[model samples]
Target: MMRRFLAILLAAAVLLPSCLRHRPGDSGEATQQKDTVLPLGFLTDAYQVDSSRVRDGETFSGLMNRLGMGARDAYTLVQRCDSIFDVRRMRAGNDVEAYYSADSSGRRLEYVVYHNDRIRSTVFQCRDSICGWVYSRPVQKVRKIADVTIHNSLWNDMIDAGASPLLIVDLADVYAWTVNFFGLQEGDRFRVVYNQTESDGEVIRIDGIDFALYNSGSFSASAIRFDQGDGGNKYWNEKGESMRKAFLKAPLQFTRISSRFTYHRKHPITGKVRPHTAVDYAAPTGTPVHSIGDGTVTLCGWDGSGGGNRIRIRHMNGYETCYMHLSKYASGIRQGSRVAQGQVIGYVGSTGHSTGPHLDFRVWKDGTPIDPLKMISPPSEPLRSENLDSLGKLYQAYLDTLSAR
Candidate 1:
């Protein structure tokens, strides 16, 4: 009986290996194996995922609570991750995700992910211990070249060419001192080489412009971005001359000339003719008014009933600029305060002797009012002699790229 039992056990062990082997047409339990891959680097296939956008007046704690996270764990996460990432900075309209795992009591929150922007996110891990970490998606920088021709306006032409709207701001900044954007005519052309930043195949923003060429009528100009190795970067021409000037071409961007400077003109509000020395720029109320050049605030107050809210800045070489009919003054814009060129001093409004919202911009030379439109500003410093050659070579290379097609 012992020898018969041993023989049966040996035969059963040999057959068990063949029985466990899965075949192509087998309908056994082996086909039900679970996938082990994790999504978003945190949750596994077994967990359920839900996404939501942050609503108005909703806090991070409130969001976590709604996702089944306990109050104690939420508080612990907020407290511990304060230094690494501020939970309170989560903004409305941004996306958030919750991951849940099933237990004896049902599904429970395990992790929460907050999307900061296109390239950044924050994860709150709450499985075994309450902790959080901030992570960024990989970004790809692509070099692009564009050639645009104008038929109506620079803004419209650039937009029609499949370029980002942010590119217009960068182009304005590069040629602010030289080109007259408001006066761009038909047949004007622009060629540029720039960097576009993308994440997950979607464009986030235009990183910057490397080189640009603008031709309008017989006038032609080029701007090249060069780093000076001192944590400073500036735009320059092919001749190594800085593109910046002592004064900007306009105090505000994308505005029209409502009224030009004249010796005698009919007031829009009043019927009587008067000397309207300042140029009136018609813009919506709250349009920012910028300083034309670096200067100190000579005066910042309500100029009686005619001038409304006003700020006057005194610059070098007996130059002074005045911005009138402001809705309010910018923060810290007090008398004797130093301000830089393009700094916001006030906002446009229809206050004190105006028919509608507009900025009465005026400039003075030696206390005498001058036409703000006709005044020519000198350029800023040029590149050093030692750095000019290197910048010239780089500028030529960029120009070659622009001319490639």
Candidate 2:
């Protein structure tokens, strides 16, 4: 019985091996199953990305520069948008903003400029090459402006009007040549465009004038600086006419107009009316008197107390001017001495007449005394002809930009 069982087991093992061998070969081809293609869905279609918006007082170029724009891009933008801005003209308080895509490449830009509630300019830039907006800002919420009149000097009025001293200095520079602070008065007014930025806290100042309207008892003059191309900024009239008349009204800062030029003028000391041929300027002793125009001194002498000391000049225009009642003559100033307009020739004193210190001023034409106030002096030349075109263009451009803003 044991032998028969063993024989059966051996036969079964042999049969099992033959069956396994015939079943399959162990090749690696079973790993080749096909991969199913799944379609991709964009996340943008389901979700929007958050972005930042710019506010008023934000600069466009500054923000654009902070981005990755190269020099070429900036140059192109300025060139294409020259009518709006040159990239460098952006002010710190302008309204501007930028909209950037999630990836930060595509962008939309909007900008606006305002002077109080008055709109100066508006613009927009976008990936599609055009941009603009209805620039809205609550301007009426705050701000108060007033025209503060300044006379005799700019410093005090500017301070009283709550102007920055820095602005006062700037305003003085504009009217430096024409507005003599020494001769200012209590009636001069200044128009200043300023914002009450924070009530008593701070203010933003802009466009200030030293002599908006100067009423010097003898004459009324106002000066405004204007660009004339290569001639740069020169003072002119409100109608663009040059304020630089033939000559300034007075050579010295005289407080009062003394004796007028008259054929039969009386001598104050003599108590006898003589032919007073000049105007007297009453000022402190030793005050300097200037030559009225470019000329050579023809006389410098004393004539007792009635005339005191006097100096006469000969101008190329055949015109003559006389200065009298001088305390002393300027060094190097004598007969035949060449002098320019506003050059000091002498000082104020009670030398000639019985009155206090004063300057007796006179003008002559064809050797005849005339009203100095009525004399029309020639103006300094304007910009050279070569620069007129450039000046005109710059003026127009400035006006356009100024108007836009």
Candidate 3:
């Protein structure tokens, strides 16, 4: 049932240049182009996002090593962006794309995580778009068509693929929301088919994610994330379901549930309050804790053994989630870090007022702590109705393809 639910909901492609032209120009060396690059082909080898690709649950450092994406690349992707679409959990049924390499490594250097909700798609080519009012007047369309095939390096693949400038802009806007663009591997993943400018082939963009799939666990769960409210990169399910919750599911996916929220219970340490304010998630010495929503970091730094590495975030709706007793925070969870929801702010450990390694998870409302597991969450952003003109047909076609299989 979950597989059917996921497969039906999400999906998303690429190509490059040098794949065009009738002849490879017989010029000895000055202008001789070898292989006649495909209309669009792989720049680097493709790898599914499974255990073979992940170095850590939160990060996929090992995939970088094999794909030739070193520490610098990995660090850049991890530090700047909190959560990246790591390929370690990618399933074999998913797509793995690769575009050409501008560098000598011959890797599909530029990669992005494309979710078909169930099957993780991998496409090679341009993902970045440059936006500027390209024309004098504005134009509208009912249906859009974009068929791109590219060859050359990954960077060039995107260029030759004729990707729209607006799509690139949209990609950048949500770079922090889903996957990390900076720390791409030799063979990462990407897939898109957006609206483009007709004359002069000047591309605009496909405003946002019509439908996308993110791979995880045994079978991938379908997810379609897009933005709304002016220019916020708010992601949602294909049916416009919001993935953002009032509080994160268990602080982090890997950490174990140490304790549940209780109104009246004996305190493990002092045996006084009989009121447990937070639930604890147990983990190793340096597990990172994340900010559950978009808010200002109110407190950070060490506070003693009971609260070793304590950090707090004051949220928009007077709601807040707290992580207590950490070996350390993730760089800057300081006094004023403006963080989005689901962003990593610190690691897990035994810090303040605790025993062993664990994260004391707490949620607050009206400036008071509340049970995180109880609140109802809002839905994710949905695609604009105007944008859905071409979506129905496109979705049906993809569904036909899936059903046939």
Candidate 4:
């Protein structure tokens, strides 16, 4: 009887193997099989990959020919990329890859991949007939929060709080119209929520700021990002007032007030006690000078009356702004040219009479010289009444988040 039971067990085990054999479409064993594709969508196991960086002055054709491809084949490959990409757009320090056959044929180059940027790449298939196509790698958007108190400079304080340069630039852009970055006090604080784009676990850039709160000892303001379906996104305050004003607080960044507007002031270089109607901002040479508001250029040339390279713009409401002591005028800035707010118009320099590198900025209201620092700029279009309710809730939530942090 024991022998009979052993024989039955052996027979059952042999039949079970046949019954469990994987069918053609069965999910049991086939589910484990996955295609090992590289980031460029090529089979990873099928090729031996070699990575390189595009050297300065390296052309696409030159790079392909250097990798053992014939000149004729390289030319053909370039022609195929006419609509796909511009070969001239390839830049130095960009990543590249050459895929060779793993088995034989002297490791023939079968494909080449060029990474255009952090997320975009172009793949060129070199088998028999060359073909090219552009591919974009999947990017992940990550939300980040930053809260910082200024003990030193804004740049240093934000960097110490693990904020990227790009992120800080975005934050500054949001407050350009309202805050004077040059006048930030030591105890000024900032809190913000923003998004960063990532590929391969590396942060590429700060996408945009969702909300921000800036507080000085005397004043406080909050910026909430809101879209009104007007094809552009804008930031607003809790009362639904637009944060973007008609003019930026200052023309350039990273500067200090060296001189203020006064009627009876002693000139430093000329030793003349005269009316200095303009505000002089001390900055290094070649610092970019931006237009404070949207206006048309009325004058862009060297001034013989002590102000060297000068640019005068006439804005709306009988307002005019002038920038003097510029080393050079920005391209496309000429007489009768229209410039937008924050557009770079010139560079700081010691071009005028008796001064180092500094910007002489002046503002006029109805042909009367006024203090640029004390000039009150009007805000942009406010939020529509229908959108105010939602914006209020969003602002409250963002304010709560900032306070909690």
Clashing residue pairs found in predicted model 1: none
Q: What is each predicted model's overall lDDT from 0 to 1?
A: 0.80, 0.54, 0.49, 0.83
The TM-scores, one per candidate, come to 0.78, 0.47, 0.42, 0.74
- lDDT winner: 4
lDDT of 4 by residue, 221-270 (tens): 88999999897548999989999999999998868999999999988977
Candidate 1's residue-wise lDDT over 270-313, tens digit each?
77898889888899999999998999999999899599999999
RMSD of each: 11.9, 28.5, 17.5, 11.0
Assess the local accuracy of residue 175 in candidate 2 as a C-alpha lDDT between 0 and 100: 44
Runs with alpha carbons beyond 4 Å of true place in candidate 4: 1-58, 63-70, 80-84, 92-113, 123-137, 231-233, 253-275, 281-288, 354-357
What would the per-residue lDDT of candidate 2 be over residues 228-311, giving only the tens digit for each residue?
655544665444556555455666652566666677865665767668766667899988788767888898898665677888
Q: In model 4, what is the error at residue 320, expressed in angstroms?
A: 1.8
Candidate 3's C-alpha lDDT?
0.49
TM-score of model 4 relative to the true fold?
Answer: 0.74
Span of ten consecutive residues with least summed lDDT in model 4: 16-25
Query: What total of clashing residue pairs does each candidate reach?
Result: 0, 20, 46, 0
Candidate 1 residue runs with Cα over 4 Å from true position: 1-39, 42-58, 66-70, 79-84, 97-111, 125-135, 230-233
